[model samples]
Target: MTESIEKIVAELPSLKNVTGAWAVTDERLARGDAVFLADLGIALARTYGSSRQVWQYRSVFDHLLRLLATTPGRDNAVQALRLVGSAEVAGRKLDRYVTSLLASGHEVADLTAVFTGQASEELRACLVHELVLRGVVVEETPGIARWVTSPHWSHHPLGRLPVRLSDVESRADFPNYGAHGSSHSMPYGPLESRAPMVIADARVPSVEETTTQAAAGAMAKAVANWAEESNGRIEARLFVFAEPLDAGSVPEALLTLGLECLRGAGKKTELSVTACAPAQVWRVLFAAASSGGAYNSGSYGAYGRLAAWQSMAALAGCPEGAAVSEVEARVRDGTWHVFDADTEWFEQVAWDIGVAALAPGRRDLAVLAATDTD
Candidate 1:
């Protein structure tokens, strides 16, 4: 509904610190790098796909994005993170502060002092925030600026945001998708453990391209994974958003989305044979087949395994859930795992998971996919 910190962070680049410099010579410069890297990390964290490559915690990136996009300076956001993590303010204060800075060259030294209660860190961080917020600081080594904002689309990831738990679980969290995850789960919290994840580097496709690909890659992969993991014990579900004609034509694109994300990560996955169920009967007949003994009526694959299913979204028989036919989703472990994402659908969950899209969307559909022939 509202713009996000990730939207802005997606514009920044993930910092490797080529100098490998442990520290910067000057404090403000260091703070500038901190803010810049923070933005880049946020975008990287929010990217979607199956990369599973680990890096610095994405929350740090998102927290910094919240700081830069919402707070006026580094120190202020530091306090903001505490307040943010501690349930003080929902971080809107950061947004308001940044809005003022954007309209009128504002600085955060004052608020930084208010937050950290220390004079020096406040000054250093605030200065860094000021420069970056105004588009001055950047990662020119790669010929890139530190931060900017853009949309999450159906693919084509140039990118990239953040949010809370209690607020998220409430109806106020994401009205459209509604509240879907844990308010306070476990070691799985952003604190103790990160979910299996990846960063996206995809670009946007036209409606035709999106549906074709969404059904193929995004939709298919989600299904393939579930079907492979849950095996036939569970029936995968998808929330199709397009009209009938479009759904019928998306098998190829679905394959594209799944294969690209898999191969992009150098996994060398293969597209599983796809089976379609007519929308009317909503009938799907599963065939247990994998050239290398990957699937059968008896067993599922190992964890994080994927399989591609590109045909059910357009099933005209459409179940009761199909009333909201605009999107496709998977029913997993009693939870509706939706991943048919565009810019809008993915905003809350992916960011909450510390992920950004290689592309973007609103409709979240769980794409089940599979690993290939051994």
Candidate 2:
């Protein structure tokens, strides 16, 4: 197997004679040779940075993606995908392939299930994210959604902040800390008149009672690691309010809390707050789950999705053993009030600073402030 695959890889670079080389590879691939597929996958990874130009490798990618769409070739193709990380490398071609596979009547669950037990958790998460990016709505099954949305995978891929697919399409307008950062706040209409208001005479929960320590810890970690650059720092804190306030007052409330959290740490500054619809918040969290915090980059896989679910579960205080779909349903139902703000403390690149969410009924507000020079 090794010698035969080596011959194939060696002959592949002969661009003029590549047709004959692929003819041999095609015959072997058609027979469903998993070992050959796996070896070829590894070889493809190595070949990516070789002296040959990228376009010359198109045949290799085409074969892998073609096999990826077929049932017999699916698992081996996934293993190859794991080795090559083609979701990042192949980009649109991968998207078109996945899209075509789905259009051809392949069940999303069946395709996603191919990744189970075949790849590392992180790779699985990234693959799933790639599938979602192609507009595939993955089923919320234990093997699929649960793994991707778990918080355990969140810390491994640093600076992976997921955003909605729609947002990804309009990424030009999406906020980031980069040169293209948007100056405008996230636009949403006035809060619904029927939206729940803060109870009069309500008492703020103690730091200990506002939210579970685990939730707070996860939020802090997420905010701190939201970006890849090392020059910036992020702080996340949860605040509970007990005073009488309406949706109209959330910005001021958030501003007050923001001021308190930033006190003594740096120069005092005021934050410009904006009200975000619950639907928008849901999309952000959903994007996180779908893309594993990759922003517009192709999916990183399950960790981002898992972390988003875990964060919501912790915030809404969902019962143990709750289904991810149930949690998602609740989030989409406006159980949380969301807001984002900006301040001078950080060079507001992206939506890094002044992002916060208030839990339904409990009034627990989670605030994240981030500053990134890069």
Candidate 3:
């Protein structure tokens, strides 16, 4: 028999490399399979936002992953994930279904068993109804499943039009650096149907000067003029190259342009910032997320383009030889962060326009003098 889970949990973190070995092992830790175990490990890595939390969860997560993988089949996996997602665990729970299976003598009913045409119609209909509510279409022949539309569509403020097939590519030129666009616009209006519109990228002298009240007001007027004459919908993207330290400035500049100028007063616009600096990737992500903007790195068409995910994987103490593609896949599959990939996660988590109002501010010497300086 394999070592007890307590001992394994205690020893797993000390192993220099566990991902590869874990992938091949069927060693069960709370009844999850190998695949489930690896995914849990990655999720634990991403669970903690701080470095200290990362270290604290390392061993517990490693041991938790030693459980078996997620249960197979679409309906079964969904039900299993939902159950565990609701259950509380110190580390990620791989497959709670298996735990139930071992505990209940196979009495628990599942959609997979009902599809054989042996189960009662009432039971099968109940499962089918649930899948329909989830917007999933299931085929009985091959047991295939597909989404009628992305469940994520309504979750994003921009609504559904920005789906993958409709993404547009355009370009902009700042004085010093060139920008390429990866944009998506809503299809509800003629203006958004413009496919792609070219806009000049900002070439500010420095980060501190990137955003200012005057500049924001000027851009707001321009966006207002565009919105007044047309059906209201806007989306745009631009890229910039800067040192990692200065990269945070790009999104900040873009935020002021989007938030202060056009986003309020019943308007919607999404402006994305793409950069090349690996070091500044996370900072850009947090700032963009904070301001309800979008950010990414590398080519939009290319794989392994997100520097934030790459950096997060490293920071989470992922396997030494892990590939960018592997990390990216984990990001996509929700292995790393609770929200999964920051690229898409940020889009959904963006701050709502008008939720926060800008408060009055004072730069005047009179106001400053009135304040206690002594």
Best by TM-score: 2
TM-score of each: 0.19, 0.48, 0.25
Runs off by more than 4 Å, candidate 1: 1-21, 26-214, 220-367, 370-374
Give me the candidate number with maximum lDDT: 2
Cα-based lDDT for every prediction: 0.26, 0.46, 0.28
What TM-score does prediction 3 earn? 0.25
Candidate 2 residue 142 C-alpha distance from true site, Å: 17
lDDT of 3 at 188: 12
Candidate 3 wrongly placed segments (more than 4 Å): 10-161, 167-374
Per-candidate clashes, comma-separated: 79, 20, 7
Per-model root-mean-square deviation over C-alphas:
20.5, 10.9, 20.3
Q: Of the candidates numbered 1 and 3, which has the greater lDDT value?
A: 3
Query: What is the total number of backbone clashes in candidate 1?
Result: 79
lDDT of 2: 0.46
Worst 10 residues of 3 by lDDT: 365-374
**Local accuracy of candidate 3 as per-residue lDDT tens digits, 147-194:** 213353243322211222110111111011111112332111112221
Off by over 4 Å in 2: 1-38, 43-213, 220-232, 258-272, 286-301, 317-342, 351-353, 370-373
